[model samples]
Target: MRLIACIIAVCFANLLYAQTAKEIVQKADEKMRGKTMQAEMIIKTIRLTWSREMQCKTWMKGNNLAMIFIVAPAKDKGIAFLKRKKEVWNWMPALERTIKLPPSMMSQSWMGTDFTNDDLVKESSVVEDYNHTIAGDTIIQNRECYIIQMIPKPEAAVVWSKVIVCIDKKDFLELHSRFYDEDGKLINTMNSYDIKMMHDRIIPTRFEMIPADKKGQKTEMIYKNIQYNKPIDDGFFSTEKIKTLN
Candidate 1:
């Protein structure tokens, strides 16, 4: 009887020590995005009318600072975007103008694609701005995953009303996400796949964004290479650097 009681006590204690939804999100975010990251990737937009691909190099420092410099397709070459915290700016080399994104444009399409401007700017901080609850668990792509629902805090300046995220249990990689509107209607879905060994870590190199209301249209980003935890100074995220980067 004493042995059985001890075993039961240990099991209950272990259950109490399990991770919560917020902790799971933080762990997944840290595993995927280290302190800093530099990557070269291609963006592909597929629509009913046309399909186009553009290549760019991206540098991200923490969750707030990032810059992308387009390098391909003569039309978009030399264009860059700089994101610092809540602010975002676009450098248009052809026009020689650095346009700052206004608040109203935050939810608009990014570069005429399915992705929103907020997606590139990354103004939302999941760990800091959300109230997360582990709604359930399921298998995604033959791997166990925790389905976590995150609602924006009252003071969080986020566009999504709610976000349901699926994180793989083994790798902590984000497998899928569903964004909803304030009225409790589905807005769009994002999925990550094509797991690869990049820079000593397993990650989903391919990200696809599909609108819940639109068919035959989607936007995807394929990461060709990424180096995590690289040394990058704050100056790299400056507007001048955005215009000058090749």
Candidate 2:
């Protein structure tokens, strides 16, 4: 009977810790993405030999909708991408057609950058699709953080086999995350830096995604301007609406 009691206590403690870890992740996600947001950003894809830059305006509503319109780079102007719920579409002005992105394409690099399409559009929910557990603690950039480990649920369609993230304790910022593949090989690392006050929230203004095996190649995304909790209509993220932007 003593052994049975100990087993039950351990199970209960694990369940409680899981809930706490999930809540931490949810809070950090909410801090980054408010109810609605409009922002302008610049992305630089750097390689040892060459580098490319692109500028765009972005709108995001909750976790279900997001749209980006490329406004710079004369040759790539008028290109846009929209994500509505589980579907993603890309609009090309030169081709004059909208391409629906399939699940297989989500893992591909976005606009030749280190970030994947899923990273930009957020097709899968980090909170909903993964089981969270408190891994440990660490300090990043002088800020104390809670290290959380996330494993994909059996039914989830996420790409990473395992994700370990460090969340700032005070502000709930995601300071860093390491992504592993199915074979438990480290695939990429994302580091968030340049913390500042954007509108009413304190967050990271610059994010860098670096490939694990690649050398001298990384993508940097920096926010130029952002407004949180703005009012944006749902119609703005539709396929028909994206085409009209061109």
Choose the strongest candidate by lDDT.
2
Clashes of each: 0, 0
Each candidate's TM vs. the true structure?
Answer: 0.90, 0.98
**Candidate 2 minimal-lDDT segment of 10 residues:** 237-246
What is the C-alpha lDDT profile of model 2 across 144-186, one tens digit per residue?
9999999999998888899999999999999999999899999
Q: Measure candidate 1: CA RMSD.
A: 4.6
TM-score of 2: 0.98
Clashing pairs in 1: none
Whole-model Cα lDDT per candidate? 0.88, 0.94
> Per-residue lDDT for 219 in model 2?
98
Error of 2 at 55 (Å): 0.4
| lDDT tens per residue, model 1, 166-239 | 99988899999998888999988999999989997999999999998889999999999999998999988998
